[model samples]
Target: MEPEAKWNGSSDQVEFSRMSPRSQGFTKLPGQKTCGKSVLLFTFVLLISAALWGTLLFLFITRYQEIVQDLGKLRESCVYHNDSGILTVIGQLQETQLNLKTNVPQLSKTLNKLQEDQTTLKSKASQFSQQLNRFEEDGTAFRSQVLNEKNTATQAREKLQEEIQKLWIEFQRANGSICTKCPENWQVFQKKCYFFGKEPKTWAQAKYACINLQGRLVSIKSREEQVFLNRNANKKGSWIGLRDLDIEGIFLWMDGSSLNYTNWGRGEPNNQGQGEDCVAMRGTSGLWNDANCRGQQDSWICEKLATC
Candidate 1:
């Protein structure tokens, strides 16, 4: 059957009635057009998404290459600084080793010199000790020799004293055996004899007369002899043996003996007139006076040993 077609008042739409089966299958439906439009819009959106992803990937690759180059430069700078510091430390160690080598020999020489000085001091000390020992031995020997000499001198002196004592004893025994006596006109006292002359004579004449009688002028030895002579003087001035004929004021006995005792009167024997050289005993006072040897004449006394 044939279908009827009607035109509507719209410009793009048409209405159709029932048609044959073959024509109906070939004609486009309104719902099929709408489905095609939707598929086109979905394809356009997918293409835009793919283009934006491609641009982002290209920017990331370029920035990654630049970062890798900067890291490489920094690592090279650090390696260069480490090499310079190592070389400086090695140079300082070499300088220290050279200085140690230069100083070692001088230190060794100073040590050796000190050892030599110590040895020399030890030698000098040993020599001093030996010399001191020798001096001590010599002192001991000298003291022993002096002791021996003193003992020898003492023994000789003792023997000489014994001999002198024996001789004195023998002399006394010989003198005692003799019967000693004084002359007829002489007086005896203490183993000595004295004679008083009454005739006044010069000192020289009196001295000669006494010598002729085998006697010397009286040399009074003690107070006892002087007293005895004084009594027998007969109250007259008598010449004694004392005189200063050799040197003025130095009285000596006629027998050449030293004058040990004196009985000088007041201001007497004063070298009177520088001419009185002979001594006389005053009969009244028993004191002695100096008189002129040749100008004055006086009575004299004589002395002699007894006949033994």
Candidate 2:
């Protein structure tokens, strides 16, 4: 058996070496530095966060400044508007004051002139009223005077008419008949005076008869003659010296004088022609009318130059 082959698998001889403590630990080959990778990743994320925060802060500050500038501008505009309004009001007040100052004197002058005109008009009106009052007083007095004069004249005229009427009545009454009331020495021939014995005849015949005796029919001239003849003559209608000529209504006396006085009965002398050719007295009334020349035998009236 060869001595059991030396069985220790030893290739080299063992030697004991001594080492330092720092170098004694087994060290893994340098690990890939995974901790450094984790740190880098964290730092990158922190930097991005800081940049985003700074940008947001800057945007907030700019917006705040813009808001403050707009507020200041608005306040300034309000102040400016208030000042403009005050100035406008003050200017208007000044213009009004100036206009009043310009017009006041002119208005005062016009008012004074109006007062003067009113005074003049009042004076004229007062004068006119006084004149009118005087005229009225004068007119009233004149009317009274005229009325008094008219009354006096009317009374005088009425009295004269009454006297004339009384005279006419007295003459008529005395001439109505022949009586002892007649004149003395008068002989009654048919109630009229005659020369003792005178023949009674017609108007034409007696006219001729009287002519032969140098006398004519009685001519009545005055109121005394009428009264005397009326009292003494026969009172059937008697002839008068008055007669109408052949010309229709032309009456005249035998003396060829137109009769200015005529005493005729109402509507008498209608000239009933045929045989009525003479003018006669209608009785003692002294009224006359046309009648027949020989109407009737009443009396004869003769006229002669007065013997006594």
Candidate 3:
């Protein structure tokens, strides 16, 4: 300061010193030894750093609010989609339930119908079984009846064969020499010709019947002849040639021969009040009886010479 003052306080220097601090701020300061350049530089840098940090904090706060808003929107969207998904699942469940409801009754009805059909089949099978059993029993009975009938027929055939054999033998013995054959429905015995009447007739009618056929009433002359006549006659009595019409208590034959053979029953030939005068032989016993000439008798026997 002394050095500059020695230069005789020049007018310009004095004026510069009297200028304001604001105008000469970098130039000088009161009681400041020298200018603090490095301190100023450090202060400027700190201010710049504070301003940059304030800008970055403002940007971060603003972006954080925007991000929170975006998150809220996303949460709403997720909730809506979840609700829709749940509704869809519920709808599907309801559809499935409806389908089951519709089909269950139909299936149940089908099952019941099948069961009924099975029961009906069982009943039909039972009925068929019973019918089969009845048929079997009927078949057994029919077979037994047939067997019995067959046995009876066999026995009857054997008896018929025996009778035929006897008849053939008798035929041979009776007609060996004459070689004669009897008429249809007629039986042969010994060598005599006989006609046995099945219908009833009066004694006189019987006599006439025999005469019409070139024969006469049978004259039983011997015991063998009586037996022969009895064997051929039917169940009832038959007219003979013997009669007492010419005289009471005296019998004569139709051929004008006297009655030589007699086989009267135990209580016969009484010649009751009606005046029985005709003669008939009992078919069963071959005994004699005196009956009325006009009375009806079961049969009559006619005799003729064998057809020689």
Candidate 4:
């Protein structure tokens, strides 16, 4: 509150005033109001641009990371899928091997059975071959034996036939005087030949009478002689070929020859309790029978001593 001072309107004072904000020139500066507005606008624009750029860079990095992560996950998934596929392939292989193992024993058993069957067939074939060989051998032996037997039989038959022919010829040559019966005065000389037409007598008496005359009763050596004697002997009875003087009462011939010829009638020479020392000729039946000796007889033949 000082009292009124003196006023001096000088140039310095005017300049100073003008420099102050209260000066008119300060107020009239070009675009001063719009400068603050322009600064604010520029700041806002820079901030907005920086934020947009940062956002864009962040978005690009995030998108790039996401793509990279997705690629990695895809690779991992591919690896896992490949490993799983390999494992599956391995599992299939193992199962195949297991199946093969399971069938091996059965296959071996089948092979063994086949081998056994082959062996059995071979054995059967061998047996059949042996049987065939044996059959052939037996057939050969049998043929040889049959041939030998046939030859032997033929030789024997030929020999036997020759002997039979010789015997028949000898029989024919000897049959003339030896097989004939003679008359009363006549006498057969050989093979028990005899004469008839004398008186009948007991066989024993006839045999004694012949013996006293140095002859024997008629003794036969052949069927022809027996037939001749049977035809010539008298009807009552006469001496014949047989006598019982040897051991065990067996009949023998007076000529010391074997009694090989016999023509006994049925039931004849069945010696009774009485002695049967001589043989008698049966006239009707033309056979011989046993009888007692020491009976009478008529004419008889005396056997002469052999001259040769």
| Cand. 3 TM to true fold | 0.41
Higher-lDDT candidate of 2 and 4:
4
**Per-residue CA lDDT of candidate 4, range 179-233, in tens?**
3433345555452224453756666556566656545565567786556655665
1-308 per-residue lDDT for model 1 (tens digits): 56777788887987876667887799899999999999998888888888888778777877787778877887788779978988888888888778778877987788788888888888988898888888888878888677757645653553455345445545765777442468989988776688888888989889888979877788888898888888888587988888877678778786555778878899886776758999888888889988888854457898776654
Give the poorly placed runs of model 4, Cα more than 4 Å off.
1-184, 189-193, 200-204, 294-308
> How does each model score on lDDT?
0.79, 0.64, 0.79, 0.65
What order do candidates take by TM-score, descending?
1, 3, 4, 2
User: Cα RMSD for candidate 2?
Assistant: 32.9
Candidate number achieving the greatest TM-score relative to the actual structure: 1
| Residue 67 shift from truth in candidate 1, angstroms | 99
lDDT of 3 by residue, 142-178 (tens): 9989987985686466446545645765776677645
Runs with alpha carbons beyond 4 Å of true place in candidate 1? 1-175, 178-180
Per-residue error for 96 in candidate 2, Å, reads 99
Clashing pairs in 2: 191-232, 192-232
Clashing pairs in 1: none
Once model 3 is optimally superposed onto the true structure by TM-score, how far is the C-alpha of residue 4 displaced, in angstroms? 99
The estimated TM-scores of all candidates read 0.43, 0.34, 0.41, 0.35
Model 1, position 138, has a per-residue lDDT of: 81
lDDT of 3 at 23: 51
Superposed on all Cα atoms, model 3 deviates from the true structure by an RMSD in Å of 32.3
